[model samples]
Target: MYPDELERYHRQLLVIGREAQEKIRRSSVLVVGVGGLGSIASLHLAAAGIGRLVLIDNGKVELSNLQRQILYTVDDIGKPKVYSAAHRLSELNPGTSIHPIYADATPELLREVISGVDVVVDGLDNWETRIIVDKICYELGKPYVHAGIHGFYGQLYIAWPGKTPCLRCVFPRPPRRGNGDVIPVFSTTPGILGLLEANEALKIISGVGKPLLNKILVYDGKTGLFDYVEIRDADCRVCEE
Candidate 1:
C-alpha cells in the first residue's frame, strides 16, 4: 500500500489487518443499481478502498430521490444517476476506480459487466430485474449480495452459486408488481439494508467474516426485530442447470 493509501485506510487496516486490506484493494464489485440501496452500499465500498466498482442504473436523479438517495444533491436532479453517483463516489475515494454505466440491466449488459467483477451487489427495486441478476450471477459463479426494502421492512441474503439457494429458490416467482410502480418506503429502511449488503461484500472480499448464506435475513424497522428464514435448495432451473 502506498503511504497515502495507508493513511487513508489506516483505521480499516487496524480492523482487517494489512493482508486483508490488500485483498480489499484488489477486489472489484458490480453494483446493479444506484438508487437508495446502491447509493449507500457503493459509497462504503469505495470508502473502504475497493479497487474497482461498476455501477449500472438507467434512471436519472429526481426530486423524490432526495429522501433516501444520499449520493446526489439538488444540483444532480436532472443528471443521469450513474454519472452523479460516480462523481460523488470518486470525490469520496479518488483511489477507487468508478465505472458508471448509464444503461438498463439487460441480460447482455449484465453478462458484460458481471464477467469482470469479484462480487455482485443487488440494489434493484423490482423483482423482475432482481431475478435476472440472480440468474446471471449464479450462472457466472459470482458471490451475489442481495437485499430488498419495502416500507419499513427489508431483507438481505448472500447467494453463493452451487453452495447456497439462489434468489429464485427462495421466491419461486416474482412478487406482484406494486401499485402504480411506486411502493411506499421509509428512507431508513434501504439505508440499513444497503449498509448490511456492503458489510457482507466486505467480509466476502476480505475473508474476515462469515456471510449470510443459505438463509434470508428479514428486518422489520417498525418493531426493531430481525428474523431468519432458513432456505433449502429448491427445484429451481436457474442454479440447477
Candidate 2:
C-alpha cells in the first residue's frame, strides 16, 4: 500500500489489520448489476480498497432510478449506468481499478468475467439472471454473495460452491412474473441489503468474520425484523457434479 492508500484506509486497517487489509487490496470482485443494490454494494467495495471491480449492466440512468439508485443524479439520466458508476467509484478511490461492462450478463460473459474474479456479488433484480449467475459461480467454484430486495423486504445468502447449498438448491424454480411487470420496492430496501452484501464480501475477502455460509438471512423492513433460515444440501444439478 502507498502512503496515501495507507492514510485513506487507516480506520479500516485498525479494524481488519494490515494483513487482512492487504488481502482486501488484492481481491477482485464481479458485480452483475448496477441498479439499486449494485450501486450501493459497489460503492462500499471501492471505498474499502477492493483491488478490482467489474461492473455489468445494460441500462441508462433514468429519473425513476433516483428514488433508490444512489450512483446517479439527474444530470446522468442519459448516460450508461456502468460508465456513470465507474466514474463515481474512481473518483471515490483512485487506488481501486474499475472495469465497467455495458452489456447484459449473458452466460458467455458471466463465465469469462467470473473466471478472473475472486468473488461474485449479486445486484440483479430478476431471478432468471440471478439463477444463471449462481449456476456459473458454482461451476467455477467461486464464492457468491446473493441478495434480493422487494417491497420493504430482502434476503441474503452466501453460496460456497461445494460446502454450502447453491442457489438452485434454495429455489428449485423461480417465482412467476409477467413480462415487463414492474416490482414494487421501498427506497431503503436495497440500501440495507446492498450494505449487507458488501459486508459479507468484505468478510470473505479479508478473512475477518464468518461468511453467511449455509444460512439465508431475511429482513422485513415493514416490521424492522431480521430472520435466518438454515440451508441444507439437496439434489441440485448445478452443484451435484
Candidate 3:
C-alpha cells in the first residue's frame, strides 16, 4: 500500500487498516441505474477505493434530476448518466477504475459486466428491472444491497444469494400498475436511501461491519425512526429458499 492511500483512508483504515483497505482496492462493484440512487451509491464506492466500478444507466440527466441526483449538476442536464458518472467518478477518485456502459443495461446486459464484480447495488427505480436482476444475481450467487424510497420512508436490505432472502422473497413479483400507486418522494428521498445503500456496500466490501442481511431497515424521515423487519420466508422463488 502506498503511504498516501493509508493517509487517504485513515479513518476507515483506522480499525481494519491496510488489510481491509487492500480488500477494497481488489474488489469491483456493478452499480445498475445511474439515477438518483445509483448516482450517490456509485460516488461513495469510488471514493472508498473500490478497485473497479461498472456503471450502467440508459437515461440522460434531466432538469428534474438536479434536486437529488448528486452525480450530475445543472450543466449535465442532457448528457447520459453513465458517461457523466464515469467522468465524475474518475475525477473523484483517480485511484479507482471506472467502466461506463452507456446503454440500456438490463439483466442480460449485466451478465457480461457482473462476471468479475464483488457486490451489486440496486439503484434502479423500476421493480421489473429489479426482479430481473435479482433473479440473475441470486442464480449467480452474488450479494446485493437494495433500497427503495417513497416520500420520507425508505427500505434497505442486503441479500446474499441462497443464504439470505432475495428481493423476490420479500416482494414475490413486481407490483402491478396502479397497485401501490405512484408514491411521491421528496428530492432527498432517493438520496437518503442511496446513502444507506452505500453504507451497506462499504460494510460488505470491507468486511468490517455487519450488513443488513435478512432484515429490511425502514427509515421514516419525518420521525427519524429506523426499524427493521426480519425476512424469514425461506420459500421464495428468487431466493430459492
Overall local distance difference test of candidate 1: 0.91
Tens digits of lDDT, candidate 1, 76-179: 99999999999999999999999999998999999989989999998899889988888888889998999998899899988888778788877777766567
Evaluate all candidate structures by whole-model CA lDDT and list the values in order. 0.91, 0.91, 0.83
Cα error, residue 88 of model 3, in Å, equals 1.0
lDDT per residue for candidate 3 within 32-92, as digits (tens), equals: 9988789888888988899999888888999877877899988888998899899999999
- Tell me how far the alpha carbon of residue 114 in candidate 1 is from the true structure, in angstroms, after superposition: 0.4
Cα TM-score per model: 0.96, 0.96, 0.92
Q: What is the lDDT of residue 201 in candidate 2?
A: 96
The digit string of per-residue lDDT tens for model 2 on 1-241 reads 7899789999998898899999999999999999999999999999999999999999999999999999999999999999999999999998899999999899999999999999999999899999889989988999999998878889998877867778888867776554557878899999999999999999999999888887889999999999999875534554565
TM-score of candidate 1 to 2 decimals: 0.96
Off by over 4 Å in 1: 234-241
